[model samples]
Target chain A: MAPLEPWEKVLISADFTQSIHGRAGCVACHRGQQSPDKDTAHVGLIPDPSQDAQRVCGVCHGEIVDGFGTSLHASLQGYRTIVYSRSVPENHPALDTAMQNHCLSCHTTCGDCHISQPKPVGGGLLNGHNVEKTPSMTRVCTACHGSRVGAEYLGKHEGIPGDVHFREGRMNCMACHAGTDLHAAEGDAAKHRYWGDQQPACKDCHAQVGRADDPIPQHTIHGNKLACQVCHAVEYTSCDGCHVAISEKTGNPFFKTEATYLSFVIGHNPWPSRERPYEYVVLRHAPVAPTTFEYYGENLLPNFGLLPTWTYATPHNIQRQTPQNRSCNTCHGNAALFLTADKVKSEELEANRRVIVENIPAAIPIP
Target chain B: MRRVGMLLLILGVGVFLGACASQGISTPTPVPTAPLPEAVLTPLSQTDYCVQCHTDKEALIETAKPEEKAPSESEGVG
Candidate 1:
């Protein structure tokens, strides 16, 4: 997406000044002097007042602010869960420094979504400070989640069609992930995104799936054995070996990943709990290594091998029919499509053992 | 010593009378009025200074700097 011009970013429309939010006046939230002089007026101005949501937005939106403390977007508990898993308490200082330098910039605020494009994408008002109840799919959500989820959902990847929900149904992220889910009060205890029940699950809308009387024989046959994405999702990007550091020359934080390639591999369920009880699920290679935080300090992630580099995934490039489910023989006995012993890197073998399939299903005999 | 004592007594009487006369002649305290009720100012009650300059497209264009491409790192790590 093209960045908004400086003039375009701050231009408030005449119509907006008459709206409910606009009527509150800029100084009511922004808290700057009402002087005519630019320098004098901006003496104590807050560029993005919603950063302190409770104090600014809370005057009217108290209920939302009350629950926002636990929201995944605000707490960033998922990132902390993954990073903390690979480090000991003693090394947390260095790991935290690395996160501050490299990760926390993606930390979002209320205004980041409702008012403007995210800061990660060079913030500008979406429409002259007019607050949008539903954020723009192209500008707000995808602006940050662009690399994988956004790419797959929007079909930005070369030759790959966009998700069926997007291409056919025209469903936005909010269509499935409602405001309640995003601002969930239950999010405080969540270790990761997949911590609880499969939210916005395929079964939620497609309730006929996996039922005994279901028309699709494959759904019944594969009941509780395979994840929906395992058969429905097409190829998605998998990354490897991401290292982070503060650039000595520029004094800016930077990261480099070894490679990113398209792959569709099914692996044993890493976490088969009550919510996600599938025996098999799609997996993606995460961009992490023991030396990822070396720039912060040596051996920062001494327990890196404790967590697998290849983690459970639900690719957004879903289709009604995919190559994996083309026929019985396509996925069965297909070693290439399975995360077998040979598929994992030699160094990652130990970490990924639980998720690696030990035996491939035999191919059905041709009648 | 008696004369000095008499003079000191006169000075003390004069100082006391002067203080009394000053207080009597001073302006009488005005009657206190009820404190004004807190006004219930509505939203957008005040003139928004931020909107004033920001809405001026010509001024913004004049001050606009050349756009610089965002760094790759800002694109984010997986």
Candidate 2:
């Protein structure tokens, strides 16, 4: 910042010559350099920071620009959201914003919704202005999510004895992760299947034998013997502590799978594990066929955040207004309870009844 | 009596069609929340801070042995 030496001034002017607008000094953008008293908010995810920076990128990286713009989500900023809509007067109901959350989340960039940056904190929301892309965004993702998901959802399991992707396919996570919408709903809301949907009972998936109308209870038979993590998980290396679990550059998990399968399984769902009525089933495997019990152990692992609070506000979980646990019967009502399977008739599981999960739990069979 | 019923019917339809719900919009009603969610700022613990990227090694998976699947021997899986 001090006056450059004569040779240094030559270099600084040479650096300035590289710019399209050579008249304005670098101080135009780096105003903080002008005076220690001023520091600009280094925020990213802003609207059209000097059109040249935001809109003119197509001149350089045409394809990346087009892809990001066509992605639809690229246009999310400077938009009205649900909160603004709700504030509308009752007399003027057709406000600009739609109440649906699907479109609204994009309006608030990923960093805004989660209240942090994507990778290594995306330079913090207020400080992300002049950043280029980095491998860290995915790390930011796993920062919020955890490694077990990579293993459980994508089939990248470390505990599978030999790592499958490592052995032959050399699969990298980007192979499966170049997507954003992870909702099982597949954009169809009729099933209301969201990654975050709360289901009173997973009986829909875990019970050995349940019709759509039956309560998904903990499997009372041998089905419970297997740990849920054994089947329902895939990649956890990135989640082990870093992101980009299996780097495409180097097709290996950042944290190699260390435990044997039996060890991993036992560590998670201990055989003869406590059979108490579990209200929370955070991670479980997808139910196996024929019997189709949506038992609690379907894809369980990770050893943390299994408490009621973590599962709260999840779409499948009935959302309580507050984070505090509502009474067990708030949604269950007297006729049916939250743990449909636990509350199921002993005869129901023995017989393997049919179940239907609506806002309420009721057995089928028009009896 | 029939004429009176007809008069009431016409009045009812007028109110239904001409009147709007507070706002001119006619929409389905929203359900009630048992209790409203209050917002509180929670501080992140260091381990939780670390969990932002890495899978928390301490995640708990719940599995149980059904009476049916109980092994004859209780030996742990090696």
Candidate 3:
């Protein structure tokens, strides 16, 4: 195990009584701290204070908590959908155990987003146990979602600068992914991560950027048909495929194989939510293969065709102008910019056939 | 002896010139790769005890969840 970073170390001795959360006192939210004896006080204490957030934070934050139950963060429907679609029975004991062991940590509780360090990435004090209205992105948001979005947005990615919004505007997650937006989802009904109007959109802030310029004719011509990310987002990482299996030797869950791709392409939008009603959007190849769950049981994902691996994606590496958007020929005739037959595997061809752009148009550079 | 000495000097000059030529052309500096992620040593949540029995759990390992070999007497803190 690696030595703990300065921030990863938990600050158990911090004075929590002076903070807003302190008004209720430690035992108010954490009921097990009654006796004042170290062991007795710790007894029956909830390990994750957020797990009991309804009783803790809900008293004051009722509305947020109400919507949060169905929010993407709480429901984790995206991960659940993957497990469900992979042929795992909903009520299977193994499924709960698998989630509790692996996926449960990623689920956000109030403290996760606001007070403490996120456990999925590693836990520590976000701000010396001081409750924060706006949590630090480095300490919170990116801790879990860091691989792609965090790297691109913060410009931590090798050979790529951070997102312009983050670089110049100094916009963190809350600038776009506001608490209201995150907490407004109808829980599990939102289905996919991008299935609702609650998710952030470039239009929310950049509603006029598309209409501002006359230099690019394609911007106007393709505005409604193409998502802003298709042209604005630079090359971002994509996990090619993932194979999940339990180790026979250890009885532990493990991924047998996973690979990443650092590039971008446009594909048909699989889910056109009200916020992103576009025919074409950027697509990132998901890390899911036909044999992803073979170790769990044979034919685990028999209906894998129900979901396309080349799903709609919004890579965070954004530029006002991109390589393909700058030249008509670069995107128009470029079969590489669009998901096509050759890009997909034979097994996924049937599922992704409808999503691949059919014909590539020859481009004449605008004089 | 002088002739042999002259040849030796010429050979030494040739070697020096070869060294200079090699130095004149800049070799590309290898880009430093980012350090690998350190194994997480501490649990994100201080109270998590799932790994006590589920030792092979990868997420717990990565997140630094604590593992208890014997049954924990600590109550209240789940």
Give the top-scoring candidate (TM-score).
1
Looking at model 1 chain A, report the run of 10 residues with the lowest lDDT sum: A182-191
Worst 10-residue lDDT window for candidate 2 chain A reads: A262-271
lDDT, model 2, position A156: 38
Q: For this target, which candidate reaches the highest DockQ against the unseen true structure?
A: 1
lDDT per residue as tens, model 1, A144-176:
989899999999899899999999999999999
Best by lDDT: 1
Model 2 misplaced stretches (Cα beyond 4 Å): A1-138, A147-163, A166-170, A179-340, A343-367, B1-78
The positional error of residue A133 in candidate 1, measured at the CA in angstroms, is: 0.4
Candidate 3 lDDT over residue span B1-47, tens digit each: 99999999999999999999988968889998999998985634464
lDDT of 2 by residue, A1-367 (tens): 1222222111222322334532232334322222212122222323222223234444554545444432223343222221232133431222222212122333223222222243212223222222223323233443333334333333334433223332344544434334332211222211222212222223333354333443533223224443232223221221111111223453322222222221110111111214312222222211112111112122121211121101111111111131122333332233332223453234233222222122342233333
DockQ result, candidate 2? 0.00
Q: By the lDDT metric, which is better: model 2 or model 3? A: 3
Better of 2 and 3 by TM-score: 3
lDDT of each: 0.86, 0.28, 0.69
Indicate the residue-level lDDT of A138 in model 1.
Answer: 89
Worst lDDT run of 10 residues, candidate 3 chain A, spans A1-10
Ranking of models by lDDT: 1, 3, 2
* Candidate 3 Cα lDDT to native: 0.69
| Model 1 interface root-mean-square deviation | 3.3
What is the DockQ (computed on Cα atoms) for candidate 1? 0.24
